[model samples]
Target: MRQWETAYEKWKNDEGLDAHLKQELDAMHDQPEALEDAFYRDLAFGTGGMRGVLGPGTNRMNIYTIRKAVNGLAHYLKNHCVNVNDRGVAVSYDSRHMSKEFAVETAKVLGAHGVKAYVFNTLHPTPLLSFAVRYLGAAAGVMITASHNPPEYNGFKVYNEDGGQVTPDEAAAITEAIQKTEDELSVPYLEQEEIEAKELLTWGGQEVDNAYLEQLESITKLDADEQEQTKDLQIVFTPLHGTACDLVQRGLDNLHFHQVDVVEEQAVPDPEFSTVDSPNPEEHQAFTMAMELGKQTNADILIGTDPDADRLGAAVKNDTGDYAVLTGNQLGALMLDYILRHTDPKLLPNARMIKTIVTSELGRRIADSYGVQTMDTLTGFKYIGEKIRQFDATGEAFIFGYEESYGYLISDVVRDKDAVQSAIFACEMAYYWKKQGKTLYDALQSLYETYGYYVEDMISLKLTGKQGSEKIARIMQAARTESFTDIGGVDVLAVEDYWTSERMVAGSSQPEEIDLPQENVVKFLLKDDCWICLRPSGTEPKLKCYVSVRGDSEEDSRKRLTKLKTAMDHFLHRTQS
Candidate 1:
């Protein structure tokens, strides 16, 4: 209680806080729970970076919190760079509350420390920011977005010079710097006008867009004839009132898809995302308006991208005359097959596809059939991006990369998952399928028949607030301590503990090292090509369990999945209790 009082006094006396934060603090002065929630602990920097609810607290995603993060980043950059002033940071944001403000604040903080800042003229997708960082040879990048989080949520993602999210080691160094900054207000910020006077701040525009688009085009395997035949294919797309409107639509047009229909209601950017309960395209509801528009146009395919345009979702008409939303695994496998089949083997003699370990192994089988290599990374797109960066450094060809959570990257143009490129590819593939007198669903069915049936599902258990955080920690600990030899009546062949960087094969004398960076994740490989992974969400207080199974038929796959899900649920309940 005494420590809490002291912290409150310091906050009250702090003159550097924004007026809104001060007001909130005053209103919550008598509310102990609110204050504790707000200041209980500073937001932790994790694999991808900081994300949280938007509010007035150290744990929130407000200007002060953003400044603290930037201050730490600035310190790290200055110390590491020989020419600190010349090394700038690229900034981009999405259509979320205060997203632009956060971008500007980040720029101001960078400028105050004598670092140049290059900011987008307006809200842009997160992947574009990653591209700009490497394109401009900037020291780092900052993207103000929560990816597909709910309306009330926002976040700050930091990228290193490699255009990948800061590696864990780099993040730890930045975290140390942030902790050294005793007061957030002590961090200096340059006024917008002052930054412009010194020409320290630059705006990204058509030049960057042109370069990015050209690179996006290079990834296409479409021939002149294919483009001509597919140009008139009817396609419906929605950005979900996010940042993908212009880039994705224009990319499709460039790909020669002439009959693209944009969902006008969602074409314009809206911070509130008024049309959908959540802007996440993974949810079928996010595509409601677009699906309706698709039906009206008799479109061959419907597509949606999240607010920041880093993730993509699609729906295709099924044999039942109803729209079936394709799972991320299904979409990824389809895209991988299409790209591999269309491209000449000579061009990609060393071509490769990448996906997270928890993603469907069906993709691996598909790649194998095409004589392409498939690599599995830990469960974040950043890991995929890291592999892409490695491929770029070497001479390996990166054909595609995706995760099971609706995020995908089709081209190496942008290091991160790019909905813009995925949108174009999805439309082009839909057109090709339509030319064969079939829908995307039909294509999926054909693939399933060719390969064995594969099924995957995710279960996320939400635990909110501080207590929830503790409980999540306990759950992870319990999983770490326990050894399950069997699940769903199948033998557990091996356990991969990412946090400990160890892979323990059942009955093995010793564990092997898992080369990926350490994170709080565990995966158990079961017999019969089935597996399950458990991890806590980086942005939210939730435990995410992923299950996958392979069977001879769709029905068999469903039965296996049902049994596995039930077993998982029983374990979850027991642990929680």
Candidate 2:
């Protein structure tokens, strides 16, 4: 029998497997493709952690896989964490199917090994989880969420003591330990009663919220009177049936934004996310209910948070009296402009902003206008969080950080992308503009007028399952082997191959070394000030291509982007889907 067949047989016959899971396995026994997809390989625990569809297989996220992943963390903690028992792991979950169960399972796995676990009593956002790690002084942390993925997906994320995702080295060490683990069915876990009796598991969240909210005082730029000035700034917020409802609402109330309205249908935690096709706020469809509420209330702005409440999306009324969804890049630039314009000059001396390499350069230009510096890291918020830690020691303050995927962090209080904080700051920005008789749309257009037209678009191609992974690998390898001279009639000024840590210029025989972690990403800088980047998604089964272009007019930029995307599609073996 093949390895997959043997693995399938073992799972099917194991009486230790849960009956429901066994039934699921048995149901797929006759479907060879389904069985192979589920058993071909272990679910990848990447630089962050494991994310996959929820089911009962080695490649799926189930009790066994959750325990196995946590077991790996336990092993790493046992070897590396000082005072592991006294400073244990903190765990929090979001509103996803089995999110709470996976969180408890992680705690139980740690508890069985005599490592204490502080688990959340209820669902919470990713930012709160990051804060709890430092607040509790835990050795590490785990958040049970898939961020903005669909409801069918859930994940486990590991964080270091500094509340940042584990570094590449840490993830590699944990992955090694995970491979050493065997007999998934035999992994032991303590029950909740036993966990409580032994003081192995405790509940958190409310206290963390208090501490986080207290810290929010220093980050929000506008004061109460300033907020009250734009009382006409009607705001509509929807958590998309996730975790941000209570906390975000409370924070806005504290600021006395009396005109705020929450989408009644999406305020409650619904694991199914029944109100929207997908809970991801990045998609326009996710804003349907929120937009309706916005129209009814004559709201000036609408905000939507994803399932884990880490990514936020918004729509602002345009000159035509219709609302237009602001792209992630647009939002980032707007926030950067607002922050730099209003921040104290004393604070501006060391204020720095961070963004991913794929993010728009408009933010960098805006920062340059203010004489502040900007830094770019690889595609994860964890790397941005790492910079926060470095900033803390070097006397540089984190003014803001954002990714092109609708994730933003306005402060270092939380070491990850924070929709709650973003929502609050975005509200203030809207109100600040409202008092000026302008909308965010007006503010964005004024920015384009000041800075040249800088527009960007991201295209993601979903190629799922085993074959999908192999295909993605092939595409990256092919790009590595071939050298490109230009794209869209623009000369390639330089090329950055992150996988090899090389920066290749046309005349330089020897490539310069990049001061960033080696990863499977390719970037090209064009002579026309346009750039395109290619990389595989770290958390999802998709190949992402990002393009940015600056032109004299919006129409000119759109034309250039169209030609550029065609060139990318041809070069990357993908079409605009």
Candidate 3:
């Protein structure tokens, strides 16, 4: 029998299988493809914790897989954490299907190991979990969420004591511990009654929320009167049937911004996410209801948060009097510009902003104008969060951190993307611009005028199942070996292979070393201040291609973007063929 077949057989005969999962297994008995897919391999725990389609096999996300992952985490914590039983772990969940179940399961596994767990009583944003880890002085934290993935998907993310996602070294240690557990089926968990009797579980509620919101409020750069003056700035917000409805509205109200409207159709917590195809705010389709509401209210801005409320997206009225959703890069630049302008000049010397390599150069330009140094990290926000912790230890300043995927961090209080804080700050930015008799669109244009006109875009090709994974590997390998001197009529100035940690300049015979963690990524630097980057996504089954260009005008920039995108699409897809 094949490896997957043997794994399937083992699972099929297990009497302790979950009833729902058992039924699913029974249904797959005659379906060879389904069986193989489910049992092909254990669900991968990569940049994000293990996430997969919910089903019956080891490779799927069921109670058993959740138990195994938590079991491994418990063992790793026991080894690394001193007095871990008292330090405990913070647990929180979003509104995804089985999210609450996963959170409970995490606590049970911890309880069995005599480790305490401070779990939120209700669904909360991912950033709050980050905050709770530090506020409670826990050894670690787990947030049960899949962020912006589709409704059928759900996963958990691990955070270290510093309230950021676990570092790469930590993840490897945890993975090693997990591999030592030979039998996931028999991993133990404490009963709810036993956990309660042992004082292993404590519920977090309004008090934690108050503490988080209090810190989140500090992200507002404006003073009291300026905050109050934002009342006239009409705003529309939609949580997209996720967790941000109550807290975001309350936060805005606390800022004295009364002209805010919530999209009633999407304000409630929904697991199915019935209103939208996918809950990711990065897509314009996710903002449909909010846009309609903006039109009805003639609102100045539209803001949205995904299921976990860690990523935020915003749209402002353009010159055409229509809502134009700002790309993550554009919004980040706008926010950075506004913050730097208002920042104390004395702090500017010590301040530093961070962004991913794939993010727009406009941010670097804006930071340069303010004398704030900029740092680039790998794609994951964990790297950015790790830097924040390092800066804190070294007594350096971290002003902001963002990525191209609609993720931003303002105050270091919450180490993750922090959509809740970003939403409030975005509103304040719009209000600030409005007070000057300008729209956010105008502010964006002014930024372009000051900086060069930059156009940035991303293309993601979804590849699913085992074959898809293999094909993605082939594409990445092809990129490393393929030779190219020009693309889209632009001469290639350089090539950066992060996997090799080398930069091969056009004329230099020797490759220069890059001082960053090794990852499977490559970048092509073209003439005319244009570039293209390629990498496989850490959280999902997609190969992402990022293209950026700066030109003399908007039209010129867009034309260059189109040509580059066309070239890249052909180059990436031809590998599979």
Assess candidate 3 and give its lDDT. 0.90
Better of 2 and 3 by TM-score: 3
What tens-digit string does per-residue lDDT give for candidate 3 at 429-485? 998899899999999999999899999998899998888889899988888899989
Residue 319 of model 3, lDDT score: 93
For the record, the alpha-carbon RMSD of candidate 1 to the native fold, in angstroms, is 1.7
lDDT per residue as tens, model 2, 302-378? 99999788999999999899889999999999999998988887778688899999999999889998988999999
lDDT for residue 29 in candidate 1, whole number 0-100: 80
**Residue 149, model 1, lDDT:** 88
Per-residue lDDT over 491-575 for candidate 1, one digit per residue giving the tens place of the 0 to 100 score:
8999999998999999998999998878899898998899999999887879899999999898999999998999988887678
- Of candidate 2, the 10-residue stretch with the lowest lDDT total is 224-233
Off by over 4 Å in 1: 2-5, 228-230, 347-349, 392-394
The TM-scores, one per candidate, come to: 0.96, 0.97, 0.99
lDDT of each: 0.86, 0.88, 0.90
Q: TM-score for model 2?
A: 0.97
- Could you tell me the lDDT of residue 416 within candidate 1? 88
